[model samples]
Target: MFTLSDMWTFFLAFFLTLPLVTLVHEAGHVLAARAFGAKIKFTLGAGKTLFKIGPLEVKRLYFMDGWCQYESLKYDKLWVHIFIYISGSLSNLAVILVINFLIYQGTLPVHIFFYQFVYFSVYFIFFSLFPFKTGEGQPSDGLAIYEVIKYGKKADPID
Candidate 1:
């Protein structure tokens, strides 16, 4: 039977897990953008800026939303844009794979976080790699990639 305590635990876990997942996911784009030498203005959340570091900005409400902005991204090569878009999901998948490898090698304990990590990795990766938009019309990374694949550079939903 589900109880109040279980509901509370679930909510608590959601908050904690969501933020970490979002950070890592966005970090994937940031890293890939940097690798492409694209000038970026990345933010992970809304509201006023809580902190700024060169091209990165952390917002006060920095847990619900995140996006990486870069100029000429719409004009970049297909591979470059693809790298920037899929890097986050790819990172999550990579982490899950590495963990599985470690488990196979008899190292690293299997625990709740491990399961949570794998679950969320596959969940987010699937959604992020799917061609869909949020209620606000923000396209998923997969949608962006599909656009590029089908229509070429002008298909960039972001600018």
Candidate 2:
């Protein structure tokens, strides 16, 4: 049975935790792009723009989605593309492992919030790593990586 408390938790997880996880995932891509000397734009969400600070933009529907767009990398190597595409999932995994370690060591109290964060982080990783192109013709992180490795170029190159 779903109680009022459960509903509140769900709301919190949906609005707050999920977006934070998404940001972490997107940040991974941005970091990788920066490492490869690519000019990038990182947007968090869709619809009306709430604010723009440098390359990072926050939108009204922040929890809906996020993406990192980068110009051609200085390296421009096959390995660079693969690393950029895979970094998002890797970042989420790193966060999950760190949180789990903290909880296990009794440094952080075991709580539902942390649990939800880890859960959503894993969810992000799984979906991000699942190869598929969206109806809008946008390739997912996994799909992009697969395309680069298999075809040696992104089918829909953002750059």
Candidate 3:
């Protein structure tokens, strides 16, 4: 039975939950980069600029995609780069754990929003950790980590 209200809830679930999850994932990268003393730019979506605040940008298509870029880390260690690479998925995992704990403890009531949040977080984690480089030559976090560890490959300099 699909009611109009149920349809709206479903739409809101995806539209709201996904972007928040994405922000969490990118924030993880930014946090790790900052820890090693690197400058960061976090861009959400593509197309015309909607707003810019500090290192964060929200574009016209806010729900389409997002990425975080950073300058060289002060540490410049293999482990530091690996940590930064994996931090995004790790951040999503942390949020899932916290939400589940809250629900289990009765601190937060069960709701469709929370469920969708958890679901999308898990979805984000899987794809982000699947090692592969894009045709556009952008290496995924997992691919970057693997390449760094396996080949001692250094990341390209920020242009």
Candidate 4:
């Protein structure tokens, strides 16, 4: 049986951890994209902005109603796109690895703290790899990459 305190702890831990995890994951994407010569934009949470930076241009609404768009010169090469897609998930995995290493090396507590951190990191990694699709009918990065590779440019398989 669970008590109110336990429920409160879970909620508090989840809310605290989710944003941190998301920021790190998104940072990974932003950094990798920039490294690969792509432009970037930033946003916070799901609500109207507390503030924004750069040019404030409106993008079309999708699953979430709207997203701030950052435009970059289109890259013809698939590798750049792949890198941008995979970087966020890779960053989350890196966090998981670092946390696990710290726990193993006795740098972090072994009980509740360790458990919650590990749980949050793992869930964050999963979500980054398989984000909810927008109403535009595009799959998440990982899924899109899989489809692109599987079907080639058309319905034909790549030789």
Considering every candidate listed, which one attains the maximal TM-score?
2
Instruction: In angstroms, give how far residue 52 of model 1 lies from its true place.
Output: 2.9
lDDT rank order: 2, 3, 1, 4
Query: Considering every candidate listed, which one attains the maximal lDDT?
Result: 2
Alpha-carbon RMSD to native, per candidate: 3.0, 1.5, 1.6, 6.6
> Considering lDDT, which of the candidate structures 1 and 4 is the better prediction for this target?
1
Q: Candidate 1, residues 1-159: lDDT per residue as tens digits?
A: 878767765664566666677778888887887786766777777889999988778888876677776655534688788778899898887878898998788797886666776787788889888899878787789988887788774333334
- The local distance difference test score of each candidate is 0.76, 0.90, 0.88, 0.57
- Model 2 agreement with the true structure over 1-159: per-residue lDDT tens digits: 888768889999989999999999999999998999988888898899999999999999999999888876888888888998899999999999999999999999999999999999989999989999877788899999888888998423354
Badly placed stretches (over 4 Å) of model 1 are: 1-12, 73-75, 154-159
Q: Which 10 successive residues of model 2 have the least lDDT summed?
A: 150-159
How high is the lDDT of residue 43 in model 3? 88
**Candidate 4 Cα RMSD (Å):** 6.6
Give the alpha carbon lDDT tens digit for every residue of 1-159 in model 3.
Answer: 888869888778657778899999999998999999988888888789999999899998887788888876888899988998889999999999999999999999999889989999998889888998776788888888899999987666555
* Model 2 misplaced stretches (Cα beyond 4 Å): 155-159
lDDT of 4 by residue, 1-159 (tens): 779779877765656555566566667766776675556664436544545556322222111222222235255356666666677778878887888898889887677655666676677567546746656664566665565566542111111
Pairs of residues at least 3 apart in sequence or in different chains that clash in candidate 1: none
Q: How far does residue 57 in candidate 4 sit from its true spot (Å)?
A: 13
Cα misplacement distance, residue 109 of candidate 4 (Å): 1.8
